[model samples]
Target: MNAQAPHRQRKSWIIWSLVTMGLALFVGANAHLAYVAFASQPDCVSHSKGSGEAHDYRAAKSAC
Candidate 1:
């Protein structure tokens, strides 16, 4: 019984360590994605003309 205590404690420590590492990785990846989204600027391309047709859709506002 006493010998099992150390083994169980070691296993619990390993599980908690893995969980912490996984959370850190998740947060780091999201932070990197957010940084890229904010840091990069993409040029806008022209779209098809609306021509006031029902099928055609126009942007509410143009960025270019």
Candidate 2:
């Protein structure tokens, strides 16, 4: 077959790299956001809102 054009080859490589990097960045950002949201979330409550926090350590969480 005839040789492919240089411009076409470079364009394909550029498009492929951009798509992969875009996916990587999107996933990385979402993971980071999830980590921060959960890790920094307010403690779970089991008091007035969580069984009225009867000083029950057995409570799944504490509040009030």
Top model number, TM-score: 1
Model 1 segments beyond 4 Å from truth?
A: none
Worst 10 residues of 2 by lDDT: 55-64
Tens-digit lDDT track of model 2 for 24-56: 999999999999988895756544444445663
**Which pairs clash inside model 1?**
none
TM-score, model 2 to reference = 0.57
Clash statistics: count for each candidate:
0, 5
Q: Rate the local accuracy (lDDT) of all candidates.
A: 0.90, 0.77
Compute the lDDT for candidate 1.
Answer: 0.90
Give the local distance difference test score of model 2: 0.77
